[model samples]
Target: MSDIPAPELAIATRNLSKQFDRLLAVDNVDLEVADGEVYGLIGPNGAGKTTLMRMLAAIEDPTTGDIYLQGERLDPDRPNPRLKRYLGYLPDDFPLYDDLTVWDYLDYFARLYDLREPGRSRRLLEILDLVQLIPKRDSLIATLSRGMKQRLSLGRTILHEPVLLLLDEPVSGLDPIARQQFREIIQVVREAGMTVLISSHILSDLAQLCSSIGIMELGCLVESTSIQELYQRLSQQRLQISLLGDNLAKSLDRAIAELRNCPQVESWTVGDRQLTVHFNGNETDSANLLRQLIQAQVNLYQFQIETDDLEDIFLQLGHQQTS
Candidate 1:
C-alpha cells in the first residue's frame, strides 16, 4: 500500500489569552490544527469562541500568548502581507455590495487581491463553482436569499486561494437544505487540503464534520479531543428497558432484581416502569442482559442502550464549568 502523506501543521496557538477591560474574553488556550483538517470550536453564547478565532486570524491581538502559522510566529502588531495571501476569514455577519452583481462583487475582491487579468477571471469562475453560486453570477446581490448571500461571502473569502479558512457561524441562519449544502462545500474544501476552523453552537454539524473539536465555556476550553476519543470516553453502557404493565413499579423492581443477580450485570435502577442496567462489560455484555430479561419472562416492550450523544456531553461539560 502507498504511504499516506502526513498532514502539515497549519495553525497553532500557545497560551493564547484575551481580555476585555477586567473581563477575560478568552482564557489561556492552546490549539493545533493540521492542514486539510476540519477543527470545530463549539460553545454556548458568550463562551469566547469568536474572540479566539479573531485572534488566530490576526484581526485582533491577544492580551497574552502567541500564534503561529505554518511554523512561523504571527506578528500581530506588524501584520504580514504574505500571511493574508493564504488566509481567508468569514465572519458571522457577511457584508455585501447591494448594487453589485454576484460576479462583479467577486471580481472587485479579486482585483483587490492583485490577480492579473487572466488569473482574475480564472479564480472568480473557480470560486463561484466551488461555492455553487455560478447560476447566480449575473444576479444582483440584493435579490439573493440568506443562504445565497452566505455562499457569495464564502466565494469572496476564497477568491485568492487561501490555504487556511477561519469561518464563524457559517450556517447560523441557513435553512436545513442550505445548511446541508454549506456542509458539502466545506467537505469539498477539506478534500482539497484546506484547513478549516469553524465555530458554531450546532453540535450535530460539528459531530458530523469535525475530526477534532474543542468545547469552550466561560472563556476557557474545557474539552479538546478527537471524535472517536470522545465517543469512547463518554460511552454509556447502561441499558434502558421499558415494560408494558398496569403495575409498572412492580415490574420495574422485578426487572432490577433479575439484572442485579446476573454475574455480568454491575448494577440496576428502577424508574417508573423503566429498568436501567449498567453492565460490568462493554456492548458484548448487553446481549447477556437481554437474554436474562427474556428468560425471566419480563414483559419487555422496548430494550435499548442509552448512548450519550455530542449534545449530552457538551451540556455536561458546560454545566461542570459553570458550577
Candidate 2:
C-alpha cells in the first residue's frame, strides 16, 4: 500500500448504476459525501435523482457497482443490522396512518425499531420537539395540516437517531412557512452530526442549506462542488442603481446613457426606478462608476451589487432542461 491515507467519507459509490427494463435510471454515478455534510441534489423531473436515492437507502439494488458506507461495503442482499441502525430514509411517497394519533403512530414505529420503554419514550419526545410537533402530539394524524403531517413523517424516519439520513423531495409541496420550518429542523440535525443527502427541486432552499451541491442531468451527475466554489466559478456580478426624487425618469435615462458607453458595463436593463447592469469590474471599478454617475448628475439613491444565487448558477449551467 502507498503512504497516502484514504479520505474518510460518509457515503461513496463506484460506477453506481440502475436500470428498469429499457430505461437506465441511474448511470455510472460516482458520488462521495463527507461526514456531517448536508448534500443537496438538484435536477429536473425524471433525471434519476429518486432512483439514486432509493439505491442509497438500500431499498433498491443497483444493476452494477459498489456502495460503501463509512468504509464498510453495503451488501443489501444480506441482512446488516449495523447498516440498518446507521441509516434513516424518507421517500417522497411516505405514508401515515390516518386513524392513529401522532404519538401513537410514532410509538408504533418506535416499537418496530425494537426501542424499549423509557428510552423509546424519551426518543419520541425528543423527535416531537425536534420537528416542532410537540404541541400536536396527542392529535389525530388525519387532523394535522399538510405541513404537520410531513413533520410527523420526518420524526418517524429519525426515531432511531440514525447518523445517515436520506431525504427525497422532503419539501416538495410545503408552503413557505412550512418549508422554513423543515429547513430549520434539518439544520438542527446537521448540527447534531447527521449526514443528510436531500434531493429537491427548490433550489433556493438548497442554496441556503447545503454545504455542497450535486446537479443531475439525464441520468448523470453533471456537476458537483461546494456552493462557494460554484459561485466563484460561474456566478456573475450585477449592479442595481435606483433613482431618487420625482425626477426618477430623467435619472434613469441619464444612467442608461452613461452605461451605454461604459467599457466596464456589459449590458443593462431599465426598470421602473432603477437600472440593473451586468458589470465586468472589481470593487474599485464599481466605486469609480458610482463617482462618474454622481458627477454626471444621475441623481442616484442606492447603488448595490447583486451576486448570483444557486438558481442562477444552475440556469447558467443549462441543466434545468428536461431529460
Candidate 3:
C-alpha cells in the first residue's frame, strides 16, 4: 500500500523579497495561508501588497526567497503546468474584448484552459450564474456596467476552477451593493474549498471577510495574525474616566500618581481630568483602584472600559511604521 500524502498548505512564503534596483519592494516577508482560508494582504498604496501578490501568482519573479503552493516549491527549473491549473489571478484591471459577448468571452478562456464538451459549457454557465451575469451572457462586454465587468473578470479567473485565487483590490471601484455581491461570491468560493489571497486597501471589507490578515507597511509585513488574535493582543484592560471640574488636569495628575503608588494599581495616566488605570491583579484590584481614585478626591464625570478593534490595531501598526 502507498503512504498517504500530507495535507498541503494553500500558500506559503519564506523570507520573500523583491527589489527593483536599489528599492526593496517586498522585504523578507513570510506569509502562510491554509487551504480554504481567505487571507488578506492589507495596506495603503506603495506598501508592496500588489508586488507580493504578483510574485505569489507567478506573474513576476521574486529577487530573493521562495514560494510554495500545495507543498511544491516554485522554481525556475521545475516548471509545473499543474500550478497554473491550481491557481487563478484577478488583477486590479479587468481586460475584456470589446466586441465579444459575455458567454463568448468566458467560452474563449474556457477553451484556452482546455475545458471540453459538456464540462466547458457546464462550468461557464455555473460561473456566469455565480457572478450574476447569466442575464448578460449574450451582452457585449462593452455594454456591461462596471460592476458587471468586475463580475465577468472574476468569472474568467475561476473558469478553470483553480483551487487558489489571488485577487488584487477586487472591490476598489464597486458600489455598496456590488461590493456586497462580490463578498457573497467570495464566500461561495471559500465554501467550495478554494483558498484566496486578496490584496485590498479596504480594511473594513477585509475585516468582514478575511479569516486572517497581514498588515504590510513600508515594504515589510509589520504584523500577520488571525483577526481574533490581533484584537486580543491589542485589547486594553484599563478603564478611562473623564472629569469636569476646576483645575482638573492638576487634580487628576496627582490622583493618578497616588493611585499608581498603590500596591494593587499596576499603572495609571492622567491628562485634563481624563484618567486611565490598569489594574495589576484582578477585579479586586480594579475595584481598589476605583475606590482609591474617589478617596483621593479625583472627581470623575464619566468612566468606561474600551477594547481595541481591527481598525485600532491597523492604526497602531501604521504609527509604528512612521515613527
Compute each candidate's TM-score over C-alphas.
0.90, 0.90, 0.79
As for TM-score, the candidate ahead, 2 or 3, is: 2
Scored by lDDT, model 3 comes in at 0.83
Model 2 over residues 109-180: C-alpha lDDT tens digits? 999999999899999999999999989989999999999988899999999989999999999899999999
Least accurate 10 contiguous residues by lDDT in model 1? 1-10
Query: Candidate 3 — number of clashing residue pairs?
Result: 0
Candidate 3 structure quality by residue, lDDT tens digits, 19-93? 999989999988878888999888889999999989988878999888888877777566778876888999998
Q: Which residue pairs show collisions in model 1?
A: none
Deviation in Å, model 2, residue 108 alpha carbon? 0.9
